[model samples]
Target: MTRTTPARPVSVEAVFPELAAHRSRTTRLHPRPGRPGMRDSHVGGPMLWPADEPWPVCQEPHRPETEGYAPDEIRSARAAGTWPASRSWPGGGTPGEGGPVPFMGLAQFFRRDIPGLPAGPDRADLLQLFRCPLTHGSYLERRYILRWRRAAETEDADDFLATPPQLPLLRWEDELPEPCVLHPEQVVTYPWAEDDTLPAALIARIDAWEDAQASRHGREAPSYQSDLSIPPGWRVGGFPSWASTGPLTVDCVSCATPLRLLLTAGSEEMDADSHSWVPLEDRDPSPHANPTRLRFGRDRDLHVFTCPADPGHPPRWLLA
Candidate 1:
């Protein structure tokens, strides 16, 4: 089913014309549980991978594969509509003792399905993402691997890998995302209130306006931070919310070029208080809001940024 975002109650640009200068277009990936084929753009769905290519594996140190379910086991539990929340790993060992663990196929996006996608490296037309199911780095950030491919060329290969390798054990089962198809809808958005792009004077004015509105309504008013600016959910190419980390410079470590938002795997499509951003079709009571069931950094949204100047540069991820 197609997903459509309801119109904002008030046109933000009408209230604060300055926002128009910072307006950005983002494609909200309304992901819902389904069996998406390899050719489709989706989250946690089967990827169109060529047999010749080796599936990505995380060589990063992990706690020995002691006490976690295998990929097939997780899939079985999900299919049976039961979650083994308390399931323990089969073995016992310390962290950083495990060998290579296969990366999970996280997402796939076809150039034809998404608008405003950066040109793929080597003029490729498909973008695939894989993630280590465990945390990494000083921040305990989930590691990601990106692959670009020419869809036509890959699909025309003699044979395709039937299934990518899966992790032998998954200690962080909640990070596993349920396969879901994408219903991409482009929407206009603004930067977070704390973004440096906005002048201090303008921010003060906006704050005063909000206060006046709240006093008049005798309750908290519609907020620019939550209601007018940066939308929640899995999306592409929009501004990131600085509400958490207060906007750190996401520059390319190799070329020093400013990076752009490539994708977001948010925990929720819409929160209970974000009813305005809810799609009209999803207003009826349902659990579609968190269909992907992807959890990251204490349920914080994961944002991936890629260097626009050079697609080959390693992508960076932040949890906000």
Candidate 2:
């Protein structure tokens, strides 16, 4: 036998006042798009507040006052030898004798840029921005200030055998280099070898094979082949012929899967996003270098999106 449960009584005070009053308040209080709540006030529209209402006052932080200098003042200072300039130390002197002397104070160099006059130079100006064409590595030039060996002429040569320290003078320039057409993300593999191991035996075999094939054919072997009999994604062009049989294997950083090798013949035009380049025909031997074999792997990161109806879906409420 099953037991029956009694129903609980409902209280009038527990009911919502809006529903109990029988007065239906329309959600559309304002005339606007969709379900009206608050309309966005765009510029050129009529003001919401009264015309006499005081305008919202913004309290912004006060900037420090700056003094204006005339062009003649700057020119006169430079003409009178008051302007500061970096000068090299004079030769033939004791250590730290003619090292670095303060040429001018900071106050003199920190001048405002005048319209007609030449712009005042800043002390911390950069000279250049050097970038590698291949790997895009940045390099800076450092000055090695060597001191004269005082004990070289004497009996003891190692007396003055101190390591000379280098001074790093950061060089930067206003002009920027052309933006890199191919980003590192677009390229599959870095051109440089991870290790210094050279394939000596492989190189010898490749040389011998190319010579025998060329001599037998009476001309250079076809650099490119369009046959579909080759492996998937393998194309013949600038890639070394021995590369197909080479034992080198590149694993993907994400999935650790071996990538399909594709040899692009020439510098191809890339997409707008700079993600990939369009494949072009086989490049000429004289102009084009051997194509680099790049490894491909899958990107393992998962992309998540929000469910529209269920706002509190999943472990947390995230829109993305």
Candidate 3:
């Protein structure tokens, strides 16, 4: 289903004209419960893999979690209808039948599909992501195996692997992305003291605008730079919607260069009972028609980072 962005009380641009320069681009991948095609741009969507190529695998052994079951046990429990909680993991379990599919998509990004990204080798824009499902710690953070392929290489783009390989997964499934249809929106981002180190004068001006908004609205709204009001799901731009460790900035290990925000894979699309940004027409508000069914760890947001100087450099993952 197409996503509906939240509505704002008033345009920030109307308040402070100078802040308009600070805007950035962000697209929310609104992935509802639907069948995405092999060639579609989506999370958990079918991959454009070659007919003869081997499906990727992760070899890490699964250890039992104190409260959760192992990879195999989880699958079995799901099949028998004994699993706890209303839903488990993203995309709400394999296809229509709620059993373990054995693998999860960690992260996904496209060089050509996205508007502004540094070029890579072969002059062929690539579509990259990861495959992993096993957990490593008490939080059950799943690891990942990175995969990158030229978007131009697959011409026919037919034939898809029926089920994901249940083999061992790698050590870092950084960000979990669901199959989603992107609703690209271009809007300016608010400058904050944390990520953007603005001069004292600019910072004061931002504070003043926020104060005015709070006074006008009769309550404290989210700060200008904090959680810049974007729709839920996997988004590419605006500030990240932080839950756990708040905001963090990491530098690339290979070159020590500061990384740019690549993607924010969120669990749920909108906050519970939050009518803000829920679309003007959505009277039902609880869940969309065909829900995406994907969620992050404990309602956390998984952020993927990459170096702008070299896209091939090892990217970093941060939980916010």
lDDT of the candidates, in the order given: 0.80, 0.20, 0.54
Off by over 4 Å in 3: 1-7, 65-103, 106-121, 156-160, 167-180, 191-201, 204-212, 219-231, 272-274, 280-283
* Top lDDT hit: 1
* Tens digits of lDDT, candidate 2, 152-204: 12223223212212122101110111111111111111111112222455334
Per-residue lDDT of candidate 3, residues 1-320 (tens digit)? 34456545557666666656766666655555445665655666666667666766544555432232244444355346565232233432222222233456533456655555335544445555564555544566555544556766664556556555552322222222335554444343554444344456766776887787678775446545433434455667555654466456679899989887777767666664234556544567665522444455676666777777787888777766
lDDT of 2 at 243: 28
Return whichever of 1 and 2 wins on TM-score: 1
Clash number by candidate, in order: 5, 7, 21
**After superposition, which runs of candidate 2 have C-alpha atoms over 4 Å from their true positions?**
1-176, 183-200, 222-278, 281-320
Where does candidate 1 clash, by residue pair? Answer: 62-96, 63-95, 66-91, 67-89, 68-89
lDDT minimum window of 10 residues, candidate 2? 102-111
Clashing pairs in 2: 126-172, 127-171, 127-172, 127-173, 128-171, 128-172, 128-173
Candidate 2: Cα lDDT at 139: 25
Candidate 3: 10-residue stretch with minimal lDDT: 167-176
Output the lDDT of residue 307, model 2. Answer: 20
